[model samples]
Target: MRSLLLALVFALVAPALPAAAGQTLTIAKARALPLGSVVTVGGTVTTPSGAFESSFFDKGFGLQDGTAGIYVSAADDVHATPGRRASVTGTLKDSFGLLILVPTDVSLGRQGLPVFPRWTTTAGVSESTEGRLVLVAGRVTKAPASDLPYGYKFWINDGTGEVQIFVNTQTGIDVSRYHLGQALLVTGFSGQFDTSYEVLPRSPHDILG
Candidate 1:
């Protein structure tokens, strides 16, 4: 009778226990999970905390490992600067067209070298490059416009194709200095807004004549 009673107690207690965390995945594999699915990923922080800001996401940082990269959103500044390795557990979310991880927990590992930006042309920025840092050079094909209330945008074209460059107000990057036909080297995270893919410069330092 006591053994049966203990069995019943064990069954009742088990239901209240929290579920185990999902297996750790590479950033690329985590990005493949269905939206809203919980997952854990390990990578090196590619952006300093609060370096990139947007209305569509919380203040956060970018993370990348050998496989791929992703953005991690947190309510508060995580202070996970570039080159710091971290393990993030979160639910997958689609912020506009950009894939992001809304972290429930973040564990920092040892500091290491940050992932370098891949050099590509305007035509090369696409879904496969999303969330990774990239460098692209082109002439201004479209001038600045206030498409987003918090930011300004312009388009650049290499001989190959065109890509948008979005400067968020938070970055204090002055787009007014650029004009049609100006040649520039731009570097930033590859991002998507709705159907459009863009390269977002983190600061004036990311832009060069």
Candidate 2:
């Protein structure tokens, strides 16, 4: 009877196990998920080199994506450090009028190759610039120019499309290495800052060959 009871316990528990305990998910997938769903999001969290704030917060934190800002939960203790890739696991919560993943478990991950958005020059992006993260490949229209105290500004244009790019000083990249008219790829959020929409490249690493 002991052996039979043991066998019954194994049979009852075996079906409930998940096939994949830890899997990576893209930001879009994480955002689309329902609240209370368990998921993992992998991304780099860099220290904000300049001052900026988002509507999601009461007092502005020193972290910002370009000049707009970043949205993080007050419950999370993970502060932004430059050039670090973190894998965070938690439940998806829609709070503070934004979709935020409340991280229950956080761990550092091996930094992978930089990911740049794939965008075509032929597409007109000005009107649809709300909350879009895009990657565009093009020839550098201009070299990096000094913006704020801790930022660099440049422009890139494919034959069909063109956009401005911004990188913060904390990325530790030499903007001089990028030559005008050189082929390059950039990834960043597509949105308006200071009444004009622009692509704020999250990091210098986002620029790829």
Winning candidate number (TM-score): 1
Strongest candidate by lDDT: 1
Candidate 2, residue 58: lDDT: 23
Clashes of each: 0, 3
Q: Return the TM-score for candidate 2, rounded to 2 decimals.
A: 0.46
Cα shift from native, residue 43, model 2 (Å): 12
- Model 2 has a clash total of 3
**What local lDDT score does residue 149 receive in model 1, on the 0 to 100 scale?**
65
Candidate 2 off by > 4 Å: 1-77, 80-129
What residue runs in model 1 are displaced by over 4 Å at the alpha carbon? 1-22
Task: Rate residue 26 of model 1 by lDDT.
Answer: 82
